[model samples]
Target: MTETFITIFLVFMILAAVVALEARELLSTVIAVGAVGFMLSVIFLFLRAPDIAIVQIVVEILTLVILVRATISRDTHFFEDEREFFPFAINIVMIMVFLIFAFWAVKTLPRFGLNFSKVAPYYLTKGLAQTGAANIVTSVILDYRAYDTLGEATVLFTAVLGAVALLRRKAKAAENKNG
Candidate 1:
């Protein structure tokens, strides 16, 4: 069952990525990215990592909201210049790089459930005793990995602030011109 779920979700993720790349409208691209993020969260959940899944969902929501708001006052459609060779070449190179990585991963990743690392069990057993937190998730994030969590929060806050500033500046510029 897990294998089937992983296989199906892998296909979904790949398709979402392709759609996001090909989407001609910025809004559609954003939606495609959200779809990819949702699929990733589901995959993480299926792998029994609720903490990662929750983080993915929350980050995805923030990213989508910020992207939509920042883009709201501007044209939403993507304009592709047919004469642009550099971008096309870059895209081709990226696809080649992705294909190479996929090939390498297929040959290298351990079989599912085979390498059951001792890390998870250790965390689950000693998390409460070490951190004095009853909730394993809370202890894992806010105590054991507090610095990483703080860094991620700081980055996310900075991104949201930047997006808000851009939109506010654009609005002010328009208002000044009109007034």
Candidate 2:
């Protein structure tokens, strides 16, 4: 079931990316890119990573807003050039290589419920005692993987800061216009 959902999301993301690439309008391309990001967030949820999903969605929304605003404010035009035969052939070969690499990586993924990490057994056994957390998940996330959690928090903070800065700049511009 999880695999099915992931596959579906991946397909949608790919379609969105292709749409973005082919789009003639700047807004259309931005919208298509936003779709890909939102779909990726959904896939993260299906993978049981709610924290990652939350961050992904927040960043995606902020990015879309900024991109759309820029598209509207500036005189942006997407001019598609005639594709040369050599460049088109190179792109096709690169895509094929990417597909082959993706297939190989998927095949190498560990089976669900199987832990490939050497630290997993230790964490499962000692996480509770070491962290004194009742929930194993909480203990592992807060105690064992504190650094990783901190990194994620930093990323979220940076995204919020960027959004605040953008908003503040817009407000100042409005105030200057009024003054």
Candidate 3:
């Protein structure tokens, strides 16, 4: 049941991404992107990563708010898309290849509700002993997988920086125009 939901949501996210890519209106593209992120957060929840899911949803909401605000404030909402046949054909082919690979990857996924990782057992058994943390999840996340946690934090930080930079640049441009 969970697997089916996750699969459906994944497909929806992919479709949303394509919609975002093809959308001519900036607001429409932002909404499609938000849909994709919302779906991703739900998928993370389905995978039992509630912490990650919360973070994902929070970030997604912030991004959507910022982008929607920016889009609405802009004078020109629609952009003309250049329809080059050769590039469009290449993109279509690439999307087809990606879908094929995604299907193959999904087929290879282990069944839900099963402990499939060899390292999980070790973590479960020795997590507390090694990390001196009472909670196994805490021990695993903070001690055993510290590097992975750091990498995730780095990615989130980078995204925030990029968003901030974009907004700042736009503000500077507006100031210059006004001056």
Best by lDDT: 2
Error of 2 at 81 (Å): 2.3
Residue pairs with colliding backbones in model 1 are none
lDDT by residue (tens digit), candidate 1, 1-179: 99899899999999999898787788888889999999999999999888889989999999999988877768676758564799889989999999999998888877778857877798898998898998898898898889998999999899999989887757887888999
Candidate order (lDDT): 2, 3, 1
Could you tell me which 10 consecutive residues in candidate 3 have the lowest summed lDDT?
Answer: 73-82
lDDT of 3 by residue, 1-179 (tens): 89899889989999999899898888889999999999999999888888778889999999899998898988757768688899989999998999999998988888667778899999888887888887787788788888998998999899999989887757887888999
Worst 10 residues of 2 by lDDT: 134-143
Who wins the TM-score comparison?
A: 3
Rank by TM-score, highest first. 3, 2, 1
Candidate 1's C-alpha runs over 4 A off are 83-106, 153-179
Residue pairs in candidate 2 whose N, alpha carbon or C atoms collide under 3 angstroms: none
Per-candidate TM-scores read: 0.69, 0.70, 0.71
Candidate 2 similarity to native, TM-score:
0.70
Off by over 4 Å in 3: 96-114, 132-135, 151-179
